[model samples]
Target: MSPASTAAASAGPSARRQASGPAFALTAGVIGLCLAASAVPSPLYRLYAVRWHLPTSTVTLIYATYCLGVLASLLVFGRVSDTWGRRPVVMTGLSGLLVAMGLFGFASGAAWLFAARAVQGLATGIAISASGAALLELRQGRDPATASLANVVASALGVGAGGLLGAVLLQFAPAPLVTPFVVLAVLVAVLLLGMTTVPETVPRVSRSGLRIATPGVPRQIRAPFVVAGLAITCAWSIIGIYLGLAGTLAPALLHTASPLAAGLAILALGGASAVPPLVARALPPAVQIVWGTLALIGGIASMAWSLSADSAVLFVAASVVIGIGVGFAMFGALRTVGAAAPPDGRARVMAAFYIVAYAAISLPAVAAGFVAQRLGAEATFQIFGAGIVAVSVGTLLPALARHRAQHRAQHRA
Candidate 1:
């Protein structure tokens, strides 16, 4: 075997030896909390818009900033934990999150929101990479599938919880914006304590220093990789619209100022996202991609109709459909990429996937925001919806074609 293969093979046993069930659970919890914290501001963005007299463009820019931070961290430090060990990187990420929460709690204007979200994005980017790696390593004789599921479930729950918590706090608490961050700070502190008890999975390796590396896929797996990458990008871009604009759109469409209602819209999206993975885990990847894309296109079209007609109920239903679609598509894409990746190069493959996905998440929202500035929310939603449908159809065609060809060849054989 090559030296690189030998190193990875040896490292696997040691990583497994360090696995502990409790530690694995703690790591997963931390990942969930990080994601939840990231979403905490989703429901509150409209409130900021009102309080600060910010425009829709500014609000979208603030949301997009977080994605930029995530992209930067993924590109630069996504694999750093592999060299330096997971514990230190995760702990540092947790610390960054705490600081972000504090910043959010004290923010007096848009500048604070921008800085806090950037920090939160960076922290989450780091924590997720480290924690995900830790979960796979600490699978304790279970298939790595469990780790993947846990990660997705935790992320969806976190997003849902954050939006709901923000809404509740906005409704009940004296200080709407401040209380959510304060509560998040407390939760993160507890997580940090739990993290301290978790053992390191990656042994420290000598390196000159941090270097920027582009993640690469092997030539043999390039076809599936592109398919998965496009699916993930499209899925996340749809999610970006939901996260960045749903709160703003819901209140406008409903013609009400109810924070609770707005929060519920986001919660529906997040909750529905978690459902499909549990329900459709057994489906083949190609089937998952096709059905998921169909659901997404339907949801996006419904949302556009709801916006144009000013039907709040339709909007909420569409959010649920979008969530379900995102869940299935994301899970299937990850599974496809994971299955095709070389054992030793999985991290790099995932890193590249995230880079593409996050770029999709950020760039489209920024463009939509600019468009919203000119055409208004209704027109922007229609355009965005149409665009997503096009991409979904574009991705689905080749995937279905390949699946049909494979089945036909097998039948002939």
Candidate 2:
């Protein structure tokens, strides 16, 4: 952290109205809720396809629509919290999410699902961006990285837990399509209410009303911001491909056709991803980024070899390693980026970060879909893994150089 940001963060708590400890915890929970809500809809997509008699192509388009919504939302409203205060924007986003849940619960056709997804994506984008910035502001003590660590770990855990929960409900619910969303609606509604108790983190001086600001990395933060963008791209692209193929891999490469087994793989991925951030909490963000990139490069190689050898054990092992790498890489990247951002514009910077992240999630998965169609799932995994390995190497060199430079400086000091 720069001297300025470190001083500001350290000084923030005493200057602002003190928030309840539980309210700060709830702020973190809101991030988990938004991510979990995003994951829940995936299990129901197949049901949507079956009941609506939609083709796989159309189903993909529907999923893509949600991605578009998230990107657009981040672009437009990413800085609203910066201008209007964090709590109100969070409240507005959660309320929108509640409406999205209602749409899913009551949908009669694919059109309703599309609308529901669009709203859900948009709401999630705004809520999480603001809450992320709020977390930095609400952070206790002296360390500013805790919020970034929480953001990474919560997001990973949320995806896994949500996917499993959705799968279970899909398997057992009397009305599978409606039930999962209804449960989501209940959670969102509760979160919406809970927000009322949280202190607004945006300072009075920062309020300027809502403006439609594009997500941007301000000039002041370009160096770390560029590194963050690269790190996030590598980390999340690996995750995107894994999620896109993991279920298919269960049937094609892992020699398992059962849905439960596929869901377990995703759960394991999330669980593994959550662990490293906690352990690496004391490490500098730059070190974490380089180490995480190294893990990705190795994971990609192993998975490619597994595909060639048709070894399920090797594939599972690769997934676990990559997951840990993701936790460290992303937590570090986010911490670096967030720490560098000027406080008044923190929401917009976070918005920019998430935009890169969501794009990584959507674009790579789409390409993986194309690869799966043309070359078969196994070939898709191999080709994509090799491709990511190459890119990760490119990402790794710069990070390693930067880490070494930092180490040398610390030693000289």
Candidate 3:
């Protein structure tokens, strides 16, 4: 065989072995950056509010618009990669992100902020599904457990890092409002270029003559999907509600609006959460699930107390604990969801999972906003805490049942 043919013939098996390394690295990088971009605009919102002489409520509106764009785009094209291939879809998503980042330079008023956020949302919506699908497709091992765990942790880390980094960059960096986006834009451009070399996992297939129907998730996987959805939703909801406005809320409660301090609170949430995934690397997914949920319950409860007592230190500490809970539980569930699903149905199942996850992101924040307006930041957080506890319990029951059943079966075998 010629050299090219020899390479082609050998690529399939070898590629699988090499799969987790590159795919994990790439997905982590891309998703982490995407999360950072989501939060980069957060601290800057205050800057825009002040510079444009805008109300805080207006800032919330701008943020909401971004979520709207994300939700809409996901509904439309979230499953596109299932038929069109991963590379094209991901590249397109990156392009949208690049455009959104560039729009930051010109954002001088509410309209400009709105436009930038909307574009950013669209960019994220595109990238999320494509990148997630790519991660699943790239798994090369006989067992996909490790790769799936990596995917969830990487995504959590990315989100946590982005918020913390955005906070740090805005506070300590020179141009609080302008610099972060610019840096992100440059990095995104480089990533976009790098994505060109990423191997496509999904191949193109004809969409025509197919009976247009919503793809049903496989029956065998539904229970696992629920378990996965619960873990992800609970964790991400905390992130969205807290990180979304912690910069603004922390100062009000603390009697100081120091951007540096507020940003650090957000950073603590990210930093503290990052430790568990690394430590739990060797743990069984079941143990991780239970302990992680307990941590989240504890964290959420502590943060609620912080809010009620008006203590920034307590709030920060609570956030860290919760973030750890988030990392362990969310990653465990995501791994299970991916592992249980068949390969061909992966993208659609994942997309459905995201629909649940993003709903967790969007709806709670909206409720928090309303609560903030009607009661106050403190009251809103207390309500959020109550919701978290309920959700966690609801999710944990099923997971525990499944975990126990699996162990029993193993023992019987």
RMSD of each: 3.4, 2.3, 4.6
Per-candidate clash tally: 0, 0, 0
Clashing pairs in 3: none
How well is each residue in 260-323 modelled by candidate 3, as lDDT tens digits? 6566666677666666666776665666677778888999899888877778678778878987
Q: Compose the digit string of candidate 1's lDDT tens values, residues 198-258.
A: 8765544433244446566789889888888878877888877677676668778778778
TM-score of 2: 0.93
Candidate 1 TM-score, true structure as reference: 0.89
Q: Which scores better on lDDT, 1 or 3?
A: 1
Rank order by TM-score, top first?
2, 3, 1
Off by over 4 Å in 2: 2-20, 253-256
Residue 38 lDDT, candidate 1, scale 0-100? 75
The residue-by-residue lDDT of candidate 2 on 1-413, one tens digit each, is 54545445432443334533777678888898888887776666666877889876666667777788888999999998988888899999999999999998999988998898899889988898999888887763345677787888888988788877787887778898889888888888888888898877765665889788887888978878888888898888887777667767755666755555556667777888899888878888888888888988887788888878888888788878888888888988888887788766788899999999899888877777766777877788787777777777787777777778878999999
RMSD over all Cα atoms, model 3: 4.6
- Residue 287, candidate 1: alpha-carbon lDDT: 76
Best by lDDT: 2
TM-score of each: 0.89, 0.93, 0.89
Residue 337, candidate 3: Cα error in Å is 1.0
Give the CA lDDT, 0 to 100, for residue 20 in model 3: 57
